[model samples]
Target: MESLRNLPLLDQLKDQSISTLVQTSLIALIGVLLLVKLVQRLRLNLPPGPLPLPIVGNWLQFKEGLNPRNLAELANKYGDVCMLQMGQRKVLVISSPEMAKEVLQTQGVEFGSRARNLVFDMTTGKGSDMVFADYGEHWRKMRRIATIPFFTNKVVQQSRRGWEEEVDLALNDIKEMPGSTTSGVMVNFRLQLMMYNIVYRMMFSRKFSGLHDPLYVKLMTLNLENNRLAQSFKYNYGDYVPSLKPFLKGYLKEVWETNQRRLSFLRDEFLNERKRQTGEKIGVDFFLEAAAKGEISETNVLYLIQNMNVAAIETTLWSSEWGIAELINNPQIQDKIRNELDRVLGKGVPVTEPDIANLPYLQAMVKEILRMHMVIPMLVPHMNLQATKLGKYDIPAGCRVLVNAWGIANNPKYWEKPEVFNPDRFLKEKIEPTGNDFRFIPFGSGRRSCPGSLIALPILGIVLGRIMQRFELLPPPGVDKVDLRSVGGQLSLVLASKPRVVLKPRQI
Candidate 1:
């Protein structure tokens, strides 16, 4: 009878223990919720954005990823400075010129560091090159080295003849193409070759024989693949969501493989060859000397070469391609360019670098194209090294900062009829693309602005001016106008199709 009574007591004890456990769990859960609310209260001053879901955080809304169009849409709703929680990462999109000035110039030091994602990290070798490196002593040294040999006024003066000669060579090749005059010729390859030769000669004292040259084709293929992989929006999700990273193994592998191939080709074919020669200073010679002096590693020198190959060649090519296509689409613009060239340089005289200053219309046209179709819509992203206040909101340290150069340049408040491509707007106004006028920062502004702008501007004028001076760029037979539809990437705005134009030799 005593044992049976003890069993009931034991059962009561077990029930009491179960009740206590449930109470403890409920208390802990409530405490966690309160702590989370407190943390949210602390961050309540963060810029306005759509509420984000746990783990995903605004990612589900971006099916195409965080492209300019989507970001612009968000800016329209959220205001000039909107914060986005992309998974765990915080992105601050600056869409107004005033905010851009604040981020890129006013507190530039606080927001001067480069934002490195997985793809860029791989390509830049963890911020080793000048263009993608963080703002610091190493970056300063690289920038100093790059500016001296390749981007300075002295370098431009010395290389002008070679650049012009490359253009002339390309023109000669176009003339030799079968049915080039009547059936229309695709000058894209020739133009790409000309750009390659111009940069390659400066860097390696070398140039490919033609567009079809095995080495040229290989290099172009590799670089195009590299750019495609690096600039793809597909790779961004993995960077934003750590859990999604395992899915990007194949993509990351391809990027790494492509980078390795590019490095090997550059090292074996160019850098190593330059190492064998001892003579007057070329671009690589400076880098080689820097490596020899223990100022920078040989790996850095190779990356510098990689940067020049992509940055120097690809960007200029896109601009030239866009400029020429725009001229073809607008015959009136072409006539204006031709008339200016003839009046400025005289009939049949080619456009020289120094002559560019006298051609205000040409300069305006360059500005217009850069403004109308910014090659890099979201200029290489910037990051704040420490927590800082931007306008009314608090920006967390290490937040990725993107200035929508496209949105700013195209904002109606800043420019009248911003969508229209009228170079006359630039002619009437004194806005310049040298990052002075924040409304027109195609090459960006501040310490991280493209140093190659000095070279790019002159090249654009020379190439377009010469072509207009020599040939009438017209659309293919029976085609009303070249398709002006552009495909936008995270980093570039390229034409949907390669333009083919009939180059009728002008009787200049």
Candidate 2:
């Protein structure tokens, strides 16, 4: 009986060993199959480009800088559709106008989505804001709600008086400066404030006195910091190789903390002020009313405000600064625009929004400025939801697409004498900035294009017109020419040197 029991136990132990070996063999077979599939997927017909290193691919090429010009240099070497391996992420750089239209227009829907990164997610409240949100139903809903107030011509008409009033205040301030008429004054700082106030008034039906005001200072400081952090290359390591994100854990924590503080201030201070008001709403208040009705959440409303606050101020301000700098550098262009203004609105009379129609030369000059100094050079990167084909090669899913607006605009093939600043190019061509003409898309094209152009254009027109009408802008005494160096590592093409100008009040 004892011998029989030992035989049974020995048989059970042999069965257990056989079962364990079979399971191990099956797992190894499945792993090999999956590895084969991954290799096949990686061997897809990608575009022509440089060979990637072990982990950090093509990143060494950008050791100097990764500005628009630098990216353009890469395009010059590679073809129109060049692929660069940026760590684990693949970047498709569209160079030619034909390729740009294909991505931004023809196959727009296939590549319409926005790429979400760590910094953008934090600044925009995790893709809650309309501008940076991925293309989807939620993006459509937010856009529809946000655009209701600013969609019609009536909106611009209603806001005209406010714009004129602000420009008048800006002009008066320039005149009040002691010896500003003879001795030039730094205009960028003042114009930047005026631009901020105009946007503020349009949003909340109120305005801040100047940058010195506590609230204005706080808001400005926060917004600038957010932009700096969001656009900084140092913070973009994880965007390429996400596996290395653990190294930036501390920095990510700080950004999250800063964003939280910003969101709190936006909700408690700015949004709360709007909520306290009791009246029939207008402007952005229209959207706020919808939020109150539970149509949209308060959190979304705050994010929308944050987007508009930065968008409305920075784009126009930087463009205006560049416009003024260009005019100061080329006095002939200034003379021509003033001549057109004199012919249409006449000197000493306040330039109105509607008056822009009669002033074609002024309009052309604005277009030229936009073409030369693009406000948002890269125009916010786009992404593909699924694998798609552009021309000969196939693009993998989730690839980041950068439309090189600066590259296309300045390409010698597209424009003759592209380096020189000449408004006549626009006068003869008559290309609208509406993105319809792929050759010149300063405001971008397609569904993701900036809707703020309706207000931005008119404000730019009236503000620039009034300034030229009232003041003869000249470079500072010692400065022979206005400096046009660009600010590095920024979303917008900001001027490096804030040009100081002698605002000699024009005689009627």
Q: Could you give candidate 1's per-residue lDDT for residues 1-508 as a string of tens digits?
A: 8999799899999999999999999888767755764587476678888877666678778757666777888899999999888877888899988889988999888988999899989988999998889899999999988889998999999999999999999988987898778888888888999999999999988999987899999999988898899878897779898889999999999999999999899889889988898878999899988899999998999899988986798889989988988998899999999999888789998999999999999999998999887888889899998888887788889999989998889888899998877899988989989887898899999899999899999999999999899898889899978987888776788877888888899885
lDDT of 2 at 164: 87
> Per-prediction count of colliding residue pairs?
0, 0
lDDT scores of the candidates, listed in order: 0.88, 0.81
Runs off by more than 4 Å, candidate 2: 1-42
**TM-scores, in order shown?**
0.92, 0.90
Off by over 4 Å in 1: 1-38, 41-44
